[model samples]
Target: MSTVAQPDLAVLSSPWTLGPLHLSNRVVMGSMHTGLEVRDDGGAAMAAFYRERAAGGVACIVTGGIAVSDEARGGPDFAVFGADGADERFRVAVDAVHDEGGTVLAQLFHAGRYALVQGVTDRHGRPQRAVAPSALPWAAARGVVPEELTGDEVRSTIEDFAAAARSARDIGFDGVEIMASEGYLVNQFQSPLTNHREDEWGGTPERRRRFAVEVVRAVRAAVPDLAVTIRLSGADLMPGSTTDDEVDALVRDLLPLGLDGVSVGIGWHESRTPTVQASVPHGAWVSYAERIARVVRTSDHPDVRVIASNRMTDLRDGETVLRDGLVDAVALARPFLADPDIVARSLGGRFDLVNTCIGCNQACLDRSIVGAPVSCLVNPRAARELAFPARPTRRALRVDVVGGGPAGLAAAVDAARRGHTVTLWEADASLGGQFALAAAIPGKEDYAATVRAAVAELADRGATVHLGRRAAVADLAGSDAVLLALGVVPRPLDVPGADLPHVVSYEQALREGVPAGTVAIVGGGGIGVDTAAFLVESPDEVVRAAEFAERWDVDVARDVLGDVPQRLPAADRVTRPGPEVTVLRRAGKIGQGIGITSRWVAVGRLRDAGVHLVAGVRAYLRIEPGTLWILDEAGVERAVPADHVVVCAGQERAPGAEETGPDGLVANLRAAGVPVAVVGGARDASGVDAVRATSEALEAVRRLAP
Candidate 1:
């Protein structure tokens, strides 16, 4: 609808037909488990969540893993096909999407050995153990050993998929997608690593794929009028697992099974390769989809479209892939969570208005992994659309928000969006305080895109922004309400030689270039780990997919089906020339404060980069001209070579900050009889958490709005 030229992205807005189902565009809202399906609201909350995204302009919505049976449930949060009140719950969601002129697909799901949790119950309130092709322990630490499904049970599970497809059609779903990817029960049967059976279900590669083939054939017959798709694992990215040739053959087999589409996904949950994390290059797995598309195009049924997904957040990339005719559609799951209107906005040539997902996974994936409701770090209202409606307030109040960092920007934009008169002030010349610094880190380029989008949104909402201007009481005289989002200053290190000229704060080191020499980082938190990565990695290597493939040992060409080596060939780290970096922590694990989903991946990258991680430091002995002295946990002293010392110890409240008194602005504003709300680092500077900061800002402004 936008007048601006969007020739490059025209294919994204074009129509496409997947057999019986036709879509208005090539963008699909990929399935993501929001942990909201089990809400007691009879699916009202989940319905609202889907309806909002449906209205935002996705061609179709894929419901998160709907269990075909009680034993198929991945967790307690999954929606079971035959549970009590299940029809009503599913109908509500289906009607909600249909009301918004969007089609919905039910993803039939079954967790095999991956079901490691215990409290999951059947509709009859009986506990069910996990079932797989073979009895395998998913992880030794958790000790979750699943029972092997008998041959009859495997056939019954195939029937379960057909029954679920029938239920989906009765519930008004336009289509059904069998979940055969991500190492689920169907995927488990396709791999020799998990499917050790000598029966019809496993043994040879052809036999190993029989379970998936049968499930598809049954589901297709069960829903002949509806679009039947299969989510296939293009490359498991696991060692000693299913090869690429077997997967290609499986695709060829499914092409004759009357499937309407194939949505390609990569990597098992247990694979050592990074797939969805921030470090992963955007559209890194598109090549796998392209390969499958090649197989599908040359097959008997060319109408079976292929959907590419995995770190795909940009529509331009989607357009390129679609234009090139490699893949028919592109699926983006988290980008929709960041901004539900991504499709509409991009189609309107207002791509700058899109709130890009920085792929932090802090609020979304991290929470979902533990069965918490999923939300976005940049947009917290995602999945809670009903709770935080954007309706206008009774009266528009003049709201003044101080600081232009993540929290301040979020407060200003959200306040304006709710029809309030808003003004924001940033002491720095530009916005994005901590976010700007983070943008400088490798693989975090999207953080800068987020800032640009936020700034544009503020302008679109007609909020006044003053940069390089510090807000004072005089500046806020005309404000009806005040929000203090004054973000943090670096918590100064207190050890000896901390004030040396060679020493720099993490902020300074990120904003400016570090001297080329051995650098010692005095903290092992997220910032410290990021700082180490930034100091050692070249900027060019971050965006280059080939470089990433080489470093992570991904076979981009897919000749061997993108199989990962059992153990990574040793990184030529010792001889690589750059600034030698060392990260030190007083106690606890490295990357302790990082989110669960990203901590291991980030820490592994640091180790791969040859960053020396020193933990359990007894004390910082001293710092000299070219060395940092430290006492070990064993009561021994050691000197670490350091031409430059960067301190990333954490954050603290702004200088001279106080919650009460004439000297404090908060107390002064309260004494002046103006409503005051404090948020972000100004409220609590325990650490620099963008998630907490933005959430606080949104909650405070919404509560304080007139």
Candidate 2:
């Protein structure tokens, strides 16, 4: 394998100092909740999770939200300061990172109204009511209203932040970061939409900013020797919330409060705009950080570092921003989850070996939103680092991984990395399988990058990949173990005229180009919605950062001093019009199987693109030369006119098994006394997704690997 050309990352590689803390580079591992803190192993799991990333090459690691008090805790999994063994957990994690020559900062957090979950308890083991600046019901929390914090309670919360910071210093943490962004307790007080208080905590802009100001003052005074930073919302994105000027003012006030750094966070949790989802372009939120950086640069504390964060998965992009001198550093959260060694790989010019975060949010953010243990879709060993240790095998064996999809690639790499000789087979001319088709969708270019990374990793691990070869039972019989990741075949449309030339499979439409005329997409699942989004855009418009910003009306080109525009001005371009696309579903929601975090963004993109969506279809009746017929839920037959009928209904197991049905391949291999493991869509296509496929592949290798 040839070494890839390296981009100049001089600025990103430069050492920097933040107050009392010194970092090796400008890259920081931003905080993310992995639900490993509450584990019974006294933070062993969480320590391993941090140590792996720290060793991978992050200059500093920001620990996930550590609640200051019982009322501030987001949920039961949130590590609280006074909780039993909390200091021990902090000490373990800090010591582990320090052992790897890495610095870690504890992020003091308060969930505010977001902690409406039932499990949150107080010191006396009684259910604690979620507290906020005012007694308002969060829109997403149904009708449950948070109790307004009394003046005394609010002051106590300030003391809580101070105590947490003091505890972090005692635990050997390098620093402490106050989480004031993302609609948390401090952010809630800053926004009028949530803070209806008439006291000094609200009423006016300066008063509204008082809560955060006092918290900063308290925390800084408590740990004067520690490197203290605050994560501030650059733009809340919520209507009737803190204006950009007000947020800037808050930053100005906080800078004078003896802060070391400011990490800019974008959007509120309830904001309609997409912040971290895949559809959001890489570096879309950097401008907000730039805005804050400008303020910090002009302030008395010009030495304070400002970190650009959100939607920054690529280090090259981070280097670009750093080179431009817009911000002092770049903090990436989910990308580290996807590839712990993202910095090392990119620095070595082995970008192809870096598993890029596709921004799918399937496993990480989606699970974190529901308090589930957060892992990665591409790398399932993220939080399970200790369990899936990559120790070289004492006795390496021959391993055959059939099908070059994500599952097969993962298995091949895992086996090869374990010192086993691995051989991978793919019937297609190239690898990627369905991911290649997915990459054709404008916003999903990273899906192709994922495949490239997997392929590169396989080669780097000394695994042999045979393209355009279907390994039969005979071909695999001699292997010590055969891992079947044969993937899935598109479930055929079983209606009349289904074989018509105008009726194309979803794969065909994605792999090849759809017709220029109208398109009626059958099945409003993830694939169907993706196809609709693809067909509704011009071929040349690949939905990169600039184009996405334009389409979403984010006024990125506005003058820095001007009040940030809520929407961008229209720009006319001469280009071919897209096809008229309509997505149909029999039942359930469109993009049904997509992760909760990304489904809305996908559906929103379709709607914004003028794609028609039809649900409650009783049945797909038939396909004509230029139309598709469907039975509506109203018991009426509907004719959807279209030049192309794309079927994305779903998929079934690949026809790898012969006489013994779907299990024939496994049965045959077992009959020949060969070890066999079936995974991915080959094992079961029903509700099969990338997350499940890669996760199953790891489990199979864990069991099969010696």
Candidate 3:
């Protein structure tokens, strides 16, 4: 295998013209429903969110899907195109993006069968009804069959799209994108499985494609001066849905109807495929863009560009895909959430200083799926950039942060950036606490990037770091304020014979290597699942890497395999006969507190690796020399023989000999006349991960900076 040279940064930052619209660069902020609307004032919060991204150097921004009419609305939080006073309301947001030298495009959408499934109400407090091409129920819609559209109703819906496009152009948008993807209303008309009508609208493939084609034609005719684009699902990835070939054919037909560009979106809301998750390798869906680009290049409209979306988080990967001629532009949604200045940092060649997205969907998509405001786990100021703007401190004061984990590191960096003298103390030789152990897991190496970014930011901001130094109360005597981010200590299992020689804590098992043979993990939470993945050897990492390389036309054996020894020792290292692992949990379900988007990916990998899962355990009987005993949910005693027993029950607050208040060590420190703040897993008895800890620490120290 041969290696491909890295793409030139200049070419990536160069300007490109798509139809009549001219962009500053090739980067596009892909459309995503952030759930940041103000509800009363035509999405004031959503407008401010877009303004921040525009100020950060994104060339073009595609606003989240806006409903064409009240019936087409997904929820009250979504912006409505033809609502009363909507044009005046949205013009402010468009002008804000324009002020920053960026172009904004509105995505006109209709949710169809998947609208307001969770009983979401409108501004009038009335439940929204879903309309579809057929009377089929989407699994995500909770068994609510939509009312099939009549021929007259279909024509009116197409007219509604035309009216929406005209309104977008009137409101000062640079362009309008028809939302014809993601199993929505437009996509339902394109897929044969969803559009089961016997009428002219849905019979053959060509007939099924009529609705989307008509929408494009009508929208283009209604707003002739504005650029008209359509977002298409390159492949639905669902059974009985449109195939790749059909999507290619559909794009070919729609291009002649007047589409300035095509943005390829992979999968649908109902598909079981992993579209955008941490487990999925980057550039996994570039081929979808390649297929659409091929069709566009072959057609008369050769200038029609293709925007490649779906997990193109890194700029290097985006540039590689562009240099390889897969797509004309790269569209990223979550990467901007992680670092709004991703484009600016890349252009400045300060890649090391950039906070890269780790592809963890916890705070972003998972929050949106449950109707919560969307934010980033890595960058907490994503949606609240304007609400919680950073300010410099009035005076420099000495600040001491005890613990070099995520929380402490964040507080120290923030303090130093705010013009304060900051010192961070870590008892261990390293910076990351539990984060280091998490990175050692088979497929979770990306977690290390968070620690690396935090450490680099701390150094760049001139925060003094003290490793292998335990801070006593006397050490913080001269500090104006002290922050206790001292993370958590593992809790020991209280079962009889837990102190046997073969039994070890989850930390020791990962740090000191697990013993060879069968292993039993006594908990099924995030730690236990990760430990099970660690002990049992699996091909998920290798397969995902190879698959990603193949799709992007890169040399895995050279670009990936050559760095295996350094990039991933867990995959290459071998022990005497891999262990057979079993995960036991007291609850009926495993992986509690795991994100809804990536939990299934972890569980699926564990299952494919032959790891056994025993849930709903009533009691832990005992642990013998090389065996452990437990009672099943049915009260039946089960003796499980194992060479090693690993307990991952959870974490507890760090022990302190001093008298503490309800708030623990923080209150105790304040009583001692030290201005103090507490954060991280140590503050919560149940424990918090890096995301929560970092967010809490940043917020707490910001208040103390003044």
Which digits, one per residue and each the tens of the lDDT, describe model 1 over residues 579-679?
Answer: 38889999888898988878898888878777899999899888888899999879899998898999988899874236676668787777778788888
Report the lDDT tens digits of candidate 2 across residue range 1-706.
0112335788899999999888889999999998887777888888999998988989899999999988788888887876878889778988999999999999999999988557557767899778999988776665668999999999999999999999999989999999999999999999999999999899999999999999999999999999999999899988789999999999999998999999999888988888888777667777888888999899888888999888777788777778767689999999999999998888777778899888998898899878888899888888998889867998889899998888888888888878998999999999988888888876787889889988888888888888998887788889988889999988989999998898889888777776567788899999998888676653332224455667655644222112323333222322113337788998899899999888988898787767788999998888888888889889899899788888898999887844375447887898899888889898889987888899999889878876
Per-residue alpha-carbon lDDT of model 3 for 488-574, expressed as tens digits? 877999999998989999889878887577788899998998888777643345555664454434323222233443444334443
Off by over 4 Å in 1: 1-6, 541-544, 557-579
Question: Using Cα atoms with residue i matched to residue i, what is each candidate's TM-score against the true structure?
Answer: 0.95, 0.95, 0.92
Give residue 422's lDDT in candidate 3 (0 to 100): 91
Worst 10 residues of 3 by lDDT: 552-561
Please report, in order, the local distance difference test score of every candidate based on alpha carbons: 0.84, 0.84, 0.78
